[model samples]
Target: MGNLIFLSGQAAIDQIGGVVGPGDIDAQIDQAMANIERALNAVGSGVDRIFKITVYLTDMNNFESVIKMRERYFDKPWPADTTVGVSALALPELMVELDVIATRP
Candidate 1:
């Protein structure tokens, strides 16, 4: 069986070692993508190796902008994904959070 990896998304305005707060959705999404990329790299994988992803959004109304940001992270044959609008997150300021699953040889 292949190795499995779980990654957490990164955010820019996110506190370096603290909680996230209400922030720009676009910036939050970008940070989350960066976080995911870093996690993948640590395990010798890249975004292209991802097989699945789940996005947690505090506000579903901004889904369009979130999807647009997501497009920059993956290419053709994009990995399967699920987007969920939740009542709240670990941090109130976090408009979006991404989790990823990847396979490695």
Candidate 2:
């Protein structure tokens, strides 16, 4: 807790408790990233300070989409990352989930 922040897995569920995108992978990825940003911002940190990230996906075929979307969030020397393909997530409708470790500001 000194300088690191461990965030729980963030899914596509929005601020209102509804999935942001039911069957859209790209939209889901965006929402999950937004959620991650929100969590980090709440503590005075932002995505630029993330040191590591773990991604979960219900379908490995969507990995390419994740890669493309990731470029929008992180730049060169990106955070350490690990992506896993799971059979399902907390909600069946969810397609992607992201969790990250970042430094506190």
Candidate 3:
């Protein structure tokens, strides 16, 4: 509430609700981050305004890739983060998801 914006987890689904990158963790992460940016923009915030993030992945082995991708999305003093590996997600083809907490710009 107030200046805080808590967003629900965003996955790699396209505008038509179809998964964007089946069997591709890197593409899935990019799509998920795009979704996060779109949602934040819609609510008067941007990725720079984000202060925390929670990432979910189907495989923990992809953690390093996620870290590398994060560099493209966030700046220094990167948001506090937590990443978790799960057996599955809502869509079997979905490989990544991101939820964030941000402040209005």
Which one is best on lDDT?
2
- Per-model clash counts, in order, read 6, 0, 0
- Ten contiguous residues minimizing lDDT sum, candidate 1: 12-21
For model 3, the stretches where C-alpha displacement exceeds 4 angstroms are none
lDDT of 1 by residue, 13-104 (tens): 43366543346777677767777777788778888888888888888998996679658878868888899889987666778878888887
* Model 1 pairs whose backbones collide: 10-31, 10-32, 10-35, 11-31, 21-93, 22-93
Point out where model 2 deviates above 4 Å. none
Residue range 1-105, candidate 3, lDDT tens digits: 799999877999988988898998888888888888898899889989999899988899999988897798889899999999999999888888888999996
- What are the lDDT figures for the candidates, one per model? 0.75, 0.90, 0.88
Candidate 3: residue pairs that collide: none
Indicate whether candidate 1 or candidate 2 has the larger lDDT: 2
Residue 9 in model 2: shift from native, Å?
1.8
For every model shown, what is its TM-score relative to the native structure? 0.83, 0.95, 0.95
CA RMSD, predictions in order: 2.5, 0.9, 0.9
